[model samples]
Target: MKNALLIIDMQQGLFHGPHIPYAASSVLSNIRLLIKKARSSGTPLFFARHTGPDGSPFSEQSPLTQLIPELDVNVEQDSIFIKKYPNCFRDTVLLQQLKLRNIDQLVIAGMKTEICVDTTCRAAFDAGFKVVLVSDAHTTIDNPALTADNIVRHHNQTLAGPFVSLVSTEEWVA
Candidate 1:
């Protein structure tokens, strides 16, 4: 049951937009706590940053491509995988890297719950890695049809099952 913590797209660019994701502050705090625990527990930590072609918010050179300042991502220790599409695994060495580290179970958390978070969770499960979705550690902005709160709630329920295990930061850290 070797495990690794996977953080996706908690980039500075995500905060620049007008609509902050639901519970953004709480999510950040929880993720920071998770990072702290991982560091002390000797758990491996990995980050996936989104980088899109020119004109996208995640441009190659954009400062937003970097993780938020508050996150304690040590380049020498934690590995970072960059993705251009929704699925973080595609065109990325994430799977291979995880395999190299002998990681079979992944504890995943990060921003935009409906997009990268959801996509990566499904993909990781399909790829045969057991996944834990840190329930309150991910978030998204409200859409026209649903509030961000509802979106997070919907995904938390819908994504739980054979594909993913939904748990809070407390449960995950323990």
Candidate 2:
């Protein structure tokens, strides 16, 4: 099965101030590792970024709309997709790119584990792609009721098996 690494919403906005996900450092580390592996293995890498209207956080003039500087993405070397919706495929050409790359399996990692990450995982599955989440490479912010840790754990457990398979950074061979 051909696989592509899909890094979703790892933008400057998400890492700033109160929007930072839990275990941000570790999550970034894992994402870096995954990026390195994908590069070495010649696996295709696709990035999904969230954008908003003129006044929102992801406005064109905002630095937050850009990918984090720490991410190892080269504009000339990788593909970047922008979506206004939480579901990466909703308003983007993500699926088209996947089809062009002949990718049927996806290795996903990114921010807002409960939102974009979760929604994309399920949508990818429903669209008939094999999906595996770099579980530790995705994270969330604390909500009114639950801590970010709890949300991560809950989604990891709930989203496993059916929507996506889970793999830790250590166990991720690809």
Candidate 3:
């Protein structure tokens, strides 16, 4: 199957606020490795950046809206989608780009496990694309009620069970 890597909303804004599944530095490392692998294999890479309304912290020109420093992104090699909502495909060109490339499978990684990541995965599945969710390659801050670890674990198990194929970075790289 033709595959592509979709890195969603790994922006600095999400890291600054009190969020759940606190953005782990390690997730970036794993995502970087996946980017390298995808590049070497000649697979397509798509980046999603979330943009909030004017005056918001996540506004288009805000530094926080930028991708985190951990990812070695090359504009020449990657296609970037600026999204207004959690679901990357919502009114975005992501689906069109994937369709143009004939990408039937997606390897999804990035921030906010229960929100953006989960939403995008479902959208991709609904769009008729097979999804491979990198179980440990995404994260969020701790919620007031649940620890970050537990939240991550819950989404990984739950999302993987019925929504997408859960794979580790090791398995993905292999």
Candidate 4:
């Protein structure tokens, strides 16, 4: 089956913000590794960038909307989808792009585990895509109700059986 990598909202705004994602550095490392592996394997890479209204961090006019500099994003090799919502498939060309590439499976990773990541995983599943969530490659900041770690842990458990197959970066790479 053809597989692709879908990295959502790994943008400069999120990383440069006051409350950074939990395990941000390690998650970036894992995402980088996944990108490298996907490149080498000829798996297409799809990036979903969230855009917000003017004055917001992810506003189109804001530099924060740009992908983080640490990621090895090649414009010629990667497909980028601009989104306004948490679900990447919502009003986005992500599904079309994947279908064009004959990609039936998606390896999803990126920022805001409890929001975009969780939403995208389920959306992908509902859209009939086989999704594998890189458990250690997606992260988010802590909320008032829960720590970031617990949020990640909770989503992983909740999404595993019905929404996605879970794999760590090491397992995915190897």
Q: TM per model?
A: 0.95, 0.96, 0.94, 0.97
In model 2, state the lDDT of residue 110. 91
RMSD of 2: 1.2
**What CA root-mean-square deviation does each model show from the true structure?**
1.2, 1.2, 1.6, 1.0
Q: Stretches of candidate 3 above 4 Å error?
A: 16-23
Best by TM-score: 4
Model 1: ten consecutive residues of lowest lDDT: 12-21
Instruction: Estimate every model's Cα lDDT from 0 to 1.
Output: 0.90, 0.89, 0.87, 0.91
> Clash number for model 2?
0
Model 4 alpha-carbon miss at residue 79, Å: 0.8
lDDT of model 3, residue 143: 69
Clashing pairs in 1: none
Q: 9-118 in candidate 4: lDDT tens per residue?
A: 99988866788789988999999999999999999999888999888766887888898888879999799879999999999898888888888899999988999999
TM-score of 1: 0.95
In candidate 4, stretches whose alpha carbon ends up further than 4 angstroms from where it belongs are none
Between which residue pairs do clashes occur in model 2?
none
lDDT tens digits by residue: candidate 1, 1-174: 888999999888785466787898899999999999989988899998899888876787788888887897899999988899889899999999889989989999997889999999999999999999999899889899999999999999999996899999999877
Clashes of each: 0, 0, 7, 0
